[model samples]
Target: MSLSFDVFWSFRSPYSYLVTKRLVRLVEEWDVTAVIRPVRPLAVRTPDHFVRMDPLWRPYLFLDTKRTADYLGLPFARPRPDPIIQDPQTNVIAAEQPYIQNLTHLGIAACRMGRGLAYIDHVGSMLWDGTVVGWDQGDHLARAAAAAGLDHDRLQAMVDDDRDGCEAELQANEAALRAAGHWGVPTFVFEGEPFFGQDHLDVLLWRLRRHGTARRSSGEAVDG
Candidate 1:
């Protein structure tokens, strides 16, 4: 049987966006399966997470993520209309979060269809590639869904019809992440070992290779 790893991810995390393409490459290159588990962002999972974070943390994260993106040769930008609705000055989270809720639910639906990685790769690029403004507007998400081989209208309908079910799944994903010994997005867990950041990806790859992860047959083109 092929090895599988659990990916705990969030739509609001730039780190999650940054790690996705490489992850796509990993799944394509190795005979492994990614068990994509979409989780709510730290801000949502623990409302006080950002509130209690060190004052310098946000700025450092901004600087580091951009530098990391440059190092990886991927376009980077702070998402416009940042996914989490919070006061930049106060770091106070909002009560109603329509954007994140929608995106997370769609992520759940995509994962159900076995295209979760592709969905995130496409949608994450849209939000973090410094190219789009007002990412939630018009048919932006629909186009992204299409690019990931999903039907946006259908996914939306599924979410609309079973919002509670989706929330339950997200909660389960959050619990699994915590159980895996980490609270961060883009965490990849293999055999109960948690790799908690984009920087840890090389370590995760090393571990996977050590476990004898096989290469895909040459000429097998990777999917987007």
Candidate 2:
């Protein structure tokens, strides 16, 4: 009866990065299973939708995300290559794939290799710590993936080529995230309730603790 949660994450969203950082610790300290389910950010999924948003909303998001990060004791900085958007041609040439494909697969691979937490820690720290500008540059993600005992070259090749295997896994993650009732990044699902944003981690943790305790009191077995 171990409590498990699915984190629908997106690398492009600063909130997602913050959520990853905190969730890594919660998973370890609480001895709960975290299913890292990555998906494309809303910007990519519906660029026109974002473009049509009230202009004030865009700037407000940046300010709000930074303020939230400060409150959480996490680093906050705008990533280099700011918008993270690609033109149709460049996007297609880059295989037009979501960054989540690589990240989620790496998480899954790490779990398979018994290094899931390690993988989350290294990669999430680098991405969210606000140290690097262009976090997607060469060797950044690759090095983190390597730390998880994965073959960085093979993973990159699969991601770059947009291999069907990789695409399929990402598609599954997207489906799962959507089914969990959120199309946004940093959404954490517990008992079928979607808690959106890093700001909600505290609530998510409370839920996890309550669930774990209730199960334990009921004489239910817990799994690691």
Candidate 3:
């Protein structure tokens, strides 16, 4: 038997990057598949969200993400050219986002091509790992695409040709996400059950075990 789930993910969430690794491991060790649903960050989707957020929310999130990254040995840092250009003083997300649209489109294209998780691992690592400055410059994206077993030029061409189609699909993904009773990224839905957040991986695994998610024939769990 095989198992699978839908992952509602965003390009800007640190938690999404953290969960991608674990999701990859699950699929590699078990007879499972991850249906990727790429979504926009809340800051972009609902611009007023930040203004209404509690003052402590941003700071607490920063502190928690750093702590978690350290524990997992994953290098963490803010993107050099942030996907969303926000006003630091007011926490207002800019109306014109130059980066996220392109990145999200490419991610969607990868998912359409059936290698979404691989693409997420490759690209998400570069952004979250904190070492690549000007990540969108030079061959950074091209290299990441290649690493994920996707053709950089080919994906880019698809994105350029059908931007509207891609956006429509992404909009549908958001609808499905909300219908699942969660708006956050990294939400995994299995058998109509929603498992949200990185901390819930163990819980998700427990549920999978109960339902008999098939493991590798060799029966060893390896972190990829």
Would you estimate the TM-scores of all the predictions?
A: 0.95, 0.77, 0.95
Once fitted onto the true fold, the runs of candidate 1 whose alpha carbons sit more than 4 angstroms away are: 218-224
Per-candidate Cα lDDT values, in order, are 0.88, 0.66, 0.86
| Model 3 bad stretches (over 4 Å) | 218-224
Which parts of model 2 have CA positions greater than 4 angstroms off?
Answer: 86-117, 157-162, 213-224
Per-residue CA lDDT of candidate 1, range 69-120, in tens?
9999999987788888888888888998888988999999988877888898
Candidate with top TM-score is 1
Instruction: Tell me how candidate 1 scores on lDDT.
Output: 0.88
lDDT per residue as tens, model 3, 1-224 = 66777888888999999888878888778876778888988899889999999999999999999999898888899877887789998998888886998888999999988888889888998888888899989998899999999998999999999999999988998888888888887898888788999888878888888888778886443321
Between candidates 2 and 3, name the one with more favorable lDDT.
3
lDDT of 2: 0.66
Give the C-alpha miss distance for residue 24 in model 3, angstroms. 0.8
Question: What are the clash counts of all predictions, listed in order?
Answer: 0, 0, 0
lDDT of 3 at 133: 96
Model 3 pairs whose backbones collide: none
